[model samples]
Target: MSARLAPVDMTAFSPGRCARLIVKVGSALLVDPDGQVRRDWLKGLVADIAGRVRAGQQVAVVSSGAIALGARRLKLPKGGRASLEDAQAAAATGQIALSGVWAELLHGEGLTAAQILVTLDDLEDRRRYLNVSATLDRLLKLGVLPVINENDSVATEEIRFGDNDRLAARVASAAGADGVILLSDVDGLYDRNPTTHPDAVMIPVVEKLDARIESMADRGSASGMGSGGMVSKIEAARIATSAGAHLAIATGRIDHPLQALATTGHGTIFVASQGARARKAWLRGGLTAKGTIHIDAGAVEALRQGRSLLSAGATRVEGRFARGDLVVIAGPDGTQLARGLAEYDHVDAHRITGRRSEDLGTILGYAPRSALVHRSHMALL
Candidate 1:
């Protein structure tokens, strides 16, 4: 059985020290009863963000509401909930309308907000990752706000952020922002689920995240407006902080959630561990694998202890793979230990198993590369 846990403090997170911030607004805050866009709320939000921009703070907005807006606009058949496919379609339709609202509002403020839709793959590939980082860096440098969202229109079940909360956290880290603020319907995380436990206290701050805190989290939002809930939000915090950025979860009901989060104590703050390495964080948070490799126990220990996978440590390679395909690094026991792009195909890997690259020519009749997955291309799990 899972151990019982308490709540975290939210008021300790501050944004004053943050120069670049990522703010994710949930669907609950952006949609109304009519299932249409909430123009007034969006306008107010733009105004608030504009103030931050004027004050010399760079901001990235990760907004969610397109599906709800689209569902309402299209007036889909009466149903208790929107089908997953229906929701995806709605989001595609709503994105156009959503962007128009943002463009018009930001344009009126003499600021340009660029719409950037990305998928899991874009952030997974090192070259592509660097490319995106460069673009966001340039945008921030130029004083333009970037409005980022998942490429929901084209993403299939095989590849998705799964939700915007996770995506926002990733975006905050990808952009190298100073902090991430997740604005939701609730003010912060509770010690116990508030609905079931009347005496459940609201945690104010989390100095460190461990398995304990992760176990306390439940599933998706109870408000029914979005896919993310406390669990995903906490997962988001871990991602952001791992990327060397602070993360906060606060209520979107506040007039200026971002400013309040960055300045005063307004929500649950999850502090970063001491000097969490950036490269490892990118490996863990940025990349998604195309396949998996099963390595021996020795390989797992080496990778976990900050070493690379040697060709001799390989036990078996799984899936139809090509050179440079991102693959999972797992132990003999089948637990994922790391992720990296493969340097050879499955058949080639089988032939070269337990052999060093220098022996490739003599054993397999071909000269081989130095590493199965080069260190530069590898990321530990």
Candidate 2:
């Protein structure tokens, strides 16, 4: 027989510990029974976001409600299933309204909002992933909050994320967010379906997503307005934890939902597998090495000391590889030291071998990064 897992400690779920956070607001929370946007509730949530920002924590929101809101404005049916064309039309109309509301609310709080629409392809394709990551990074640095959503207007079933739960997880990983809050109709995960089984108990904390834990997830949505259910949230938890972000599933129906999550312990917190260094997670396990860099003994020592790999320390570059390709770092004695994303291509690396950082612009004909592999992007073996 297996030993019982420890009960969740509600006091540990503090937002103050997180430097960056992503919150996913569901359609059910954003739209009411009459298919109207919950303006007052949204204002409350925005105020919570403002509080987080004032505390020096960067925050992003992944929101869903465009289709439902659009359906209402277009005089279409409110609750039933919608066709693909109907969804596309609703998204086109709803996206405008969604952006306007977010802008108005955020501006009122002395914050700027940037609208970002993406599909799964944007996160899956490496080039596009880099572009999106850079854009989000810049926005955060400029003290802007990004309002991201699926490109429902143009996305087909094949390319769609299907729901915002997994999209929020992907965004958390890409943005290097330390935490994710999934605001939903339900409070948190439970051992059984609470609505059907009156004796069901809420699970406040989950340290791992084992087989038994996964089995607790239900199939269909409890909230009639959304597509994702508890099962999708579980999947999102898996993705978020693996990417080194803690995930919290909480009730969005309450006023000031984010504030409630922080103070009331009103959610299930899924602890990350480790710390919030997603790039290191990717470097350690997510990618395959495309090439190798042979470095001197001095460079090996520097890397072991948690320093970046510089071109001056590189003795040789092997194999044809492009920028951002994962490469193995080999010591002079032919022992592999680490794996990391290459900042320059094989040709550029070969050209700059044994060169100093100040000479990189002259050698490469452009201002270049100071390191061949930034320490943040490297995983020492």
User: What are the Cα lDDT values of the candidates?
Assistant: 0.75, 0.86
Instruction: Write candidate 1's Cα lDDT for 1-381 as tens digits.
Output: 011223333334455457888889898888876886677877777887898788888998998878777777777643113566776787788889988888899888879989888888888765566557667877988988899888777777677887788898788766768778888887777777777876776666777888878877878586687878899999898888777677887777766666555555656787765434553454666556767777888777777776657779998777877766677888888988777767677778778878876788787677665567755456665
> Candidate 1: where is the Cα deviation over 4 Å?
1-13, 77-81, 262-264, 275-381
Best by TM-score: 2
Q: With candidate 2 superimposed using the best TM-score fit, by how many Å does residue 279's alpha carbon deviate from the native?
A: 6.3
Worst 10 residues of 2 by lDDT: 1-10
Q: Give residue 326's error in model 2 in angstroms.
A: 1.5
**Cα deviation of 106, candidate 2, in Å:** 1.1
